[model samples]
Target: MSNCCSSSSCETTHPKKHRCPANGSEYSEVSARTIAHHIRDALRWRPTANRYFFCDDPACDVVYFGDDGSTILKSQLRTRVGVKELSNDELLCYCFGITRGDFIANPANRDFVMAQTKARLCSCDTSNPSGRCCLKDFAKPEM
Candidate 1:
């Protein structure tokens, strides 16, 4: 659940990158740990030892892909991928459970997330499907 880069499986000295078959977008490297946390228990056994990537394309059903031509769709995950969700209620910050709607309602939520993140309380690695920081995903309030 810690930094994926620290894990041996996530190390990418010579990564074998792959594109998302569903959308044909270049893959973003991800950790098996991230896949393990997001993937449904039944599908946990689906992953191979190969490196994995995250498909952030909202229009695509695929959430994870492996260098060995394996894939895990959003439907196979334990939690809804916020980026893929069409609803404003989709979670933007998994660590604090802040949804798009909540952030839109109160921009202060962003500040709270920032504070928590700065305090080293955020755990985006396991909670977030992308295994990345959620601060960049926050929707800025309209002035």
Candidate 2:
């Protein structure tokens, strides 16, 4: 037995339907293989700025490197956001003007994990919930 397919001459006979998007952009599902082929084009470099999140929270902003334990997300770019090798803590300190303590206080901002970095999230001073009061930004003494 042989199978048969038909060529259509009318819109009503078409097997698929497409709708115009209000956003003026057309979207359709693409096969995984087709997407993988464009990996190089998708992964291109762009301009960047200095490290760290612009955190205003006092606790999060002024974190330093520790000799023990892992490399946490502090004093660096937003690691969560690709193209930037920083952490949320850095943003709190530099970009947005927040501190590590205050930034950590807000649980929602805890976006990504940091390891093998200079700064990372540390235990907040339980006695003083407001990291602003506990953590102060002081210039490191010249060594």
Candidate 3:
């Protein structure tokens, strides 16, 4: 992990693992492959040989922050971070392209996703910003 925060833009407190620079929320660690999938082409070259964390805080602009204090803002991502979006149209299942609205309109979507997941067809690790199973987001399907 590159803990070297020599840049002036570096806003994180060094040595602290997985903290969002914008909101200070404890973030979830994500792999470079996950970063590469979500980050836009312009910022694809930004991922260095360092540890990256995903900030699920909807209020925070920093989506991915490195241990070195480097950050990739939400606007830098190719897809909308579902947890960060307030609209019902926000995507919920990346692997199946199911939106929050769809999930709410049909509870069966969740079951479908669960079935697909059980069948090993889901790819949340590279599709979702959190790099976690979408089923967790389904805990409270109320829109």
lDDT of residue 88 for candidate 1: 86
Against the reference, the lDDT scores of all candidates come to 0.83, 0.26, 0.81
Which stretches of candidate 1 lie above 4 Å from their native place?
1-17, 42-46, 139-143
* Model 1 per-residue lDDT tens digits across residues 1-143: 55877777984567546788778889778899888888788553766747889987778989998887788998888889997786888999999898998887888899999999999999998889898889878853331
lDDT of 2 by residue, 1-143 (tens): 12223434343533222221222222222222322222233244221311111222223332211222111232332222111223434333332334444455653333321221125344222111212221232111110
lDDT (10s digit) by residue, model 3, range 60-124: 88888888789999888888999888788898899999988898888789999999999999999
* Candidate 3 off by > 4 Å: 1-17, 42-44
Give candidate 3's TM-score: 0.81
Return the TM-score for each candidate structure: 0.82, 0.15, 0.81
Top-lDDT candidate index: 1
